[model samples]
Target: MRGTPTLLGRPVPLGEVAWLTVVWLLLWGDLTVGNVLGGLLASSVVVWLLPLPTLDSGVRIHPVAALVFLVRFAADLVLSSFRVAFWALRLGTSPPVETVRVRLRTSSEVMTVLVTVALSALPGSLVLEAELEDRELVLHVLGIRGDVRATVQADVTRLEGAIVAAFGTPADREEIR
Candidate 1:
């Protein structure tokens, strides 16, 4: 499944084995055939049994873009964690955690769900609720730096863009801007 394989003319399963193998190596902190084989089997089985829904055929992932997205996400996750930690350090005078409604850049359900997952995966934000029809999420966020509403909305847009860059069509990338 190299070079962006698609299932039923839809994009999905973006190197599932590769992701799992990398995760396995990270967990084991060693590169070995046993570990690689183990990851391949485990990941393949899971995906085969419970696969993610395929994205529309128009969705196409550029390898470079996906790599860039992964790096950016890791950096964002670390930075957001630090920001949340700094906020936690503030004792009682902590800024209020605000709920903001942010519209997503992609209207596709899968893309929207991916954005939702990305937002909830971080510590600073949680998806309070999802309005699928409207392609919006009510997110509760920490660390209101300057403008609470705009800050949250911008962060959400950034997160969505990262995902779109990693696994979206050329059209998706254009629409995000």
Candidate 2:
């Protein structure tokens, strides 16, 4: 089933095994026959014992859009870092922090997870909660004095657009729009 090789009437998840093996090798920082064999054995055991739910993921990288996404992400990271630092160093009362909920454009599991991670990575904003069923995110944002909800929602929407443009299929992009 799933075009995977069967072992004793069960499908072997070769992709998961290979990915786990690679991770093991990277962690061990060695690439030898013994390591390879051990990784394979260990990964096979883990895959069989602790099976993960299969997901389509639906990720496809578009070079141009990916580059754009990376550039924008880097810029946001840097700018937000500085803004947080400035807020920290400033004298007087603390900046206002507000929690807001923003509805996302797409609700694909992969897309939702990516957006959540991106928002958390930025310095001034953190994803407090992700409601996948409702296609929404609850965020805690710092240093916003005016129209906090709108600003946070717009930022999340833009980030979601960039992510969809970079890795989403045509249908996925349409869902976001």
Candidate 3:
């Protein structure tokens, strides 16, 4: 059972609800029932109308682990922001740009997609393409340095590990081999 719970063939995760409600509250700027219900209704409609792929790769969110991932991701985001700012401010110093291939550890399409999205969100890196056939991702990095190849590879692996630890079942963790 993943974090997303299904009701009447509709998937609704708590995060989705919170996000929707918060957006609605911010927009309406109130705590009235109408706004709350409106947000819930809107979220429900979207969740029901848009069909998301069902992930059956034994993904289950561990609350603590997921929280840990969130914390680390936030910290990384702050650090990445600073690095990106530095790159923007620097003059006449073109960072080494290169495309690196990273072999993903998982065969699960869900994990691959998750990792790809996560890595893409990091500054200076973009997932150019993923070869699901070989479970590898071709990444374009702007300002790579210090054994960039190994660093990128390790970063991908670490992100994948964090994701698996946070939202994968025991069997899935074992499959991390």
lDDT of each: 0.79, 0.90, 0.82
lDDT of 3 by residue, 74-164 (tens): 8877777777778888897776788999998887777788888888898878999999999899999876678989988988888888888
TM-score (all chains, Cα) for each model: 0.63, 0.72, 0.68
Residue pairs with backbone overlap in model 2: none
Cα RMSDs, all models: 7.8, 4.3, 6.2
Q: Comparing candidate 2 with candidate 3, which one achieves the higher lDDT?
A: 2
Which tens-of-lDDT digit does each residue in 23-96 have in candidate 2? 99999999999999999999988877787877666998999999999999999999899888889999886978
Flag regions of model 2 displaced more than 4 Å.
1-55
Q: Residue 120's C-alpha lDDT in candidate 2?
A: 95
Candidate with the greatest TM-score versus the true structure: 2
Question: Tens digits of per-residue lDDT for model 1 on 1-177?
Answer: 447655556443658767876887899888899988897777766666677765556557779978987888898789989888887888887656888998886877767878888889888889999998888899998876678888788878887887888888777778778
TM-score of candidate 3 relative to the true fold: 0.68
Worst 10 residues of 1 by lDDT: 5-14
